[model samples]
Target: MRLGSLAYEQIKERLLEGGYGPGQRLSAVELGAELGVSKQPVMEALRLLSADGLVTIIPQVGCEVARYELQEVQDFFALFASMEGTIAGLAATRCTKAGLRGLDAVSARIGHLASETDPVARSHHYRLLNREYHARIHALAGTAVVGEISHRMWDLSDFLINTSGADHPLHAALDARHDDHETIRKALWDRDAGTARREMELHILGTLSVMRPQQL
Candidate 1:
């Protein structure tokens, strides 16, 4: 990867891991020093991060990690739920036998990892499994335009969920979310578009409960 791309990935990893808190100011000079690169690469990385919705760059005030308010989170989740539901509905009829088998294998791996004792291990496994599962649906849905938009929304959602100030123990709800996968899987297997869409919509919206509502 080029220096800018490498910087983007490294900085994005820090953001996802909560190394930088939401709304925290970022210094390109400091980041460049730390990453052993010139300020140009850090600037490029920050621009990319801003485009990805992980950071906010103000013309006069500079950049800070993106801070998502409760309303913003809810709105984004609603949008994601609608889009993903539509995708699942399409996938219900579009997925080939081989694709269905691949999804089943991913579901099996997720089930196996759901019982993991180590918090880190469990989180890591679920992240991988969740990404793979949704990616499969995107492919099965077979619309590049929708898939591209969905991927961007998912990326933004991941950022919001990971960096939000709410300490609502979202991790604890992982098993419940994973369990919904079974319902979705069955609907897909049955080629029931309505059920698949409903199950997927419910599962996506369920994640909204992970965030605690702000005080009025």
Candidate 2:
């Protein structure tokens, strides 16, 4: 990877891993020192992260981690649910056979991870599998304008999920998510657009319900 890209991933990983708390100021100089890179790459990485809504940059004051309010979190997921439902419907009719296979593979991995004993490993693997499942659906949806918007929304949702952390027990959340994915997978495989849309909508709203009341 290029230096700036490498620095961006490393720094974002730290933020997701809880190395920095919400609204904590980030020093590019110190981050660069820790990351063993020059300030230039670190600053570039910070700018990219800022665009993703994970960081806020002030012209004179520098940068700090971004924080989300409960209503914002709720609204984000609600919007995602609507968008993803449309994507799911599109995938049912538009996704190629190869795309279906890819979605199946991701679902299989999620099933395996759901049985995993280690919470940390399970959470990590589930994130990758879940992301791929939705990303593929969005890509195959074939709606240029909405697809681009969906990607941005997914980015924001991902940052929130990683940084805000889950409100429910890890295992329970995994199980619930796994079940939802199974239903969505079946709908897609059967080319049932209406079922896919309904399942996906329920899946997202169900997730919101499982979250801690405070988080909502």
Candidate 3:
């Protein structure tokens, strides 16, 4: 990959994975040194991330991770829930045997997280596995346009959840989240469109409960 794209992916990955906190200052020179690149490509990456609402760049003040207000976060999740619910509905009818099996595989890994005692590891691992579990459902939907849009939304979802000033956000809700997954899995397995859609929306909006209200 080009240096600029590489920088973008690296930076964006950190942002989604909670390496950077909301509104934390980022130094291009420091990041360049870390990535073995230069300031130019680092700045290029920041600009791209800014366009995706993950970073904010100021002319004189430099760049920091993006932060959203409580209402904005809630609104984003609401929209995200609607789209994902639709996808789950489509996935209900479009799911192939192989796709459902793949989803179950991911969910099995998530189930294992309950035994993971380390807070950071459990939270991080759950975040990633939770994403794959949903991505499997997305693939089953066989959507091209909305699936593309949902991918970006998923990034933002991770960003908000991780940066909401809650330490171990996913850890706090691990058991509940796993239970939600089981409910979703059963609906998908049964090919119940209504149940899948309803369960998905509730599961996503459930994110708000664990988020810190003060920092949101």
Residue 44 in model 3: lDDT? 96
Candidate 3 regions with alpha-carbon error over 4 angstroms: none
TM-score of each: 0.92, 0.88, 0.96
Give the lowest summed-lDDT range of ten residues in model 3.
207-216
Expressed as tens digits, the lDDT of each residue in 1-216 for candidate 2 is: 999999999988776544576788999999999999999999999999999888999899999998989888888788889888988999899988898898888888788875688867776677667778888888667788887887677666656765665532335588778888888888888999999999998887676665555576
Which model is ahead, 2 or 3, in terms of lDDT? 3
Whole-model lDDT, candidate 2? Answer: 0.80
Model 2 spans with C-alpha error above 4 angstroms: 165-171
Report how far residue 120 has shifted in candidate 2, in Å.
1.2
> TM-score of the candidate numbered 3?
0.96
Cα TM-score of candidate 1: 0.92
Ten-residue segment with the worst summed lDDT in candidate 1? 207-216
Instruction: Give each model's clash number.
Output: 0, 0, 0
lDDT, model 3 = 0.92
Candidate of highest lDDT:
3
**In candidate 1, what are the lDDT values of residues 1-216, reduced to their tens digit?**
999999999998777655688889999999999999999999999999999989999998889999877778788888899999999999999989899899999989888875677765666567657889999988888989999899878777666666665542345667787789889989998999999999999998887665544411
Give the root-mean-square deviation of each candidate in angstroms. Answer: 1.9, 2.3, 1.2
